[model samples]
Target: MNDKVGIVIVSHSPDVAKGAADMVRQMVGNEVPLAFTGGDPGGGLGTSVETILAAIDRAWSEKGVAILVDLGGAETNSEMAIEMLPEDRQGRVVVCNAPIVEGAVMAATEAWGGATLDEVRRTAEELSPA
Candidate 1:
């Protein structure tokens, strides 16, 4: 596992993804690397598959990257993004189970240095509101 962990949140709109990232930063103090994808000017509505993949590449450049996505188009975008990663790095990317807000917070706050994907996943699930 990589010591540096990255977060990628995808949603139907940039605001949703960025909002999720913002929430995580609020808890974790912006120490962790996080990226936003899904929407932007001229980027079209719904999840941005290419944009998400690009963000993942950048995030993974520094460390491992995990992905969390909103429902519908975001889910499809995430899946496509995962497929785009190199085989070895693919395992480092995860689609979180919890909602974007809770999942991003759990992934960011709980992802200590050297934390594995399993640990991150567990934390996200554990921290998610029931």
Candidate 2:
């Protein structure tokens, strides 16, 4: 994998997550690893820990992964996903406290510039809170 940090978009609605991931990919290209997930197991509007975990896996990078979530529930599920990862991998994934769509784009842009995990996270967080 590339040295750039990865990006994961999480939202309660599948369409929102997919749209945000699409925007990031359009702007950042394939320079950074990217993945996204949303909705509960039944495909309703709710976050899923399992889906978040899968997104993390798809976007895995040795550098780290930054997850941008749409709401508090998404943040909570993202936390659970991070906790479920191996001890060595847990800290490498973080749930960013920023708007999902804007934050994902910003974080991905920074990651494309070869920023570290913390740098990408800070870039996302610096935006107005979601």
Candidate 3:
């Protein structure tokens, strides 16, 4: 199996996160590790550190993980989750600043192609508006 950079999708809405992940799978297949988190543990529409952490674990890889978040709150919570990881993992994970859906799709595509973390991040970030 290929050990491409992993990916995590974060959103305030669970449905949105799941849909983005689904799109990634359809577009890139499952060669790259992938996970997603959204909403609070209480089932409300908000970001959650716990859920984000869990998603990170699910998508963890020595190749590292690239996170795509849907909103400010999701990004903030994703940062918190990254801080909570071990030092080794902390350094490898990155939160990409790009559109959640499009970014995730492109990020996964890069990862599946064996791109490095930075390359995958750039692939997603390039999707952003100038």
Query: What lDDT tens digits, residue by residue, belong to model 2 across residues 1-130?
Result: 5699999999999999999999998987977999989888886899998888999999999999999998889999899999999999998999888888889999999999999999999999999754
Please write out the lDDT profile of model 1 over residues 73-110, one tens digit for every residue: 78777888788877988877888877888888878776
Name the top TM-score candidate.
3
lDDT of 1 at 79: 82
- Residue 35 of model 2, lDDT score: 93
Instruction: Please identify model 1 stretches exceeding 4 Å from their true place.
Output: 40-44, 61-63, 127-130
Which residue ranges in model 3 land beyond 4 Å of their true spot? none
Say which prediction, candidate 1 or candidate 3, comes out ahead on lDDT. 3
Clashes of each: 0, 0, 0
Model 3 clash pairs? none
lDDT of 3 by residue, 1-130 (tens): 5389999999999999999999999988988899998888889999999889999999888889999998899999999989999888899999999999999999999998889999999999998989
TM-scores of all models?
Answer: 0.85, 0.96, 0.97
lDDT of 2 at 92: 96
Angstrom error at residue 57, model 2:
0.4
- Model 1 residue-pair collision total: 0
lDDT of each: 0.75, 0.92, 0.92
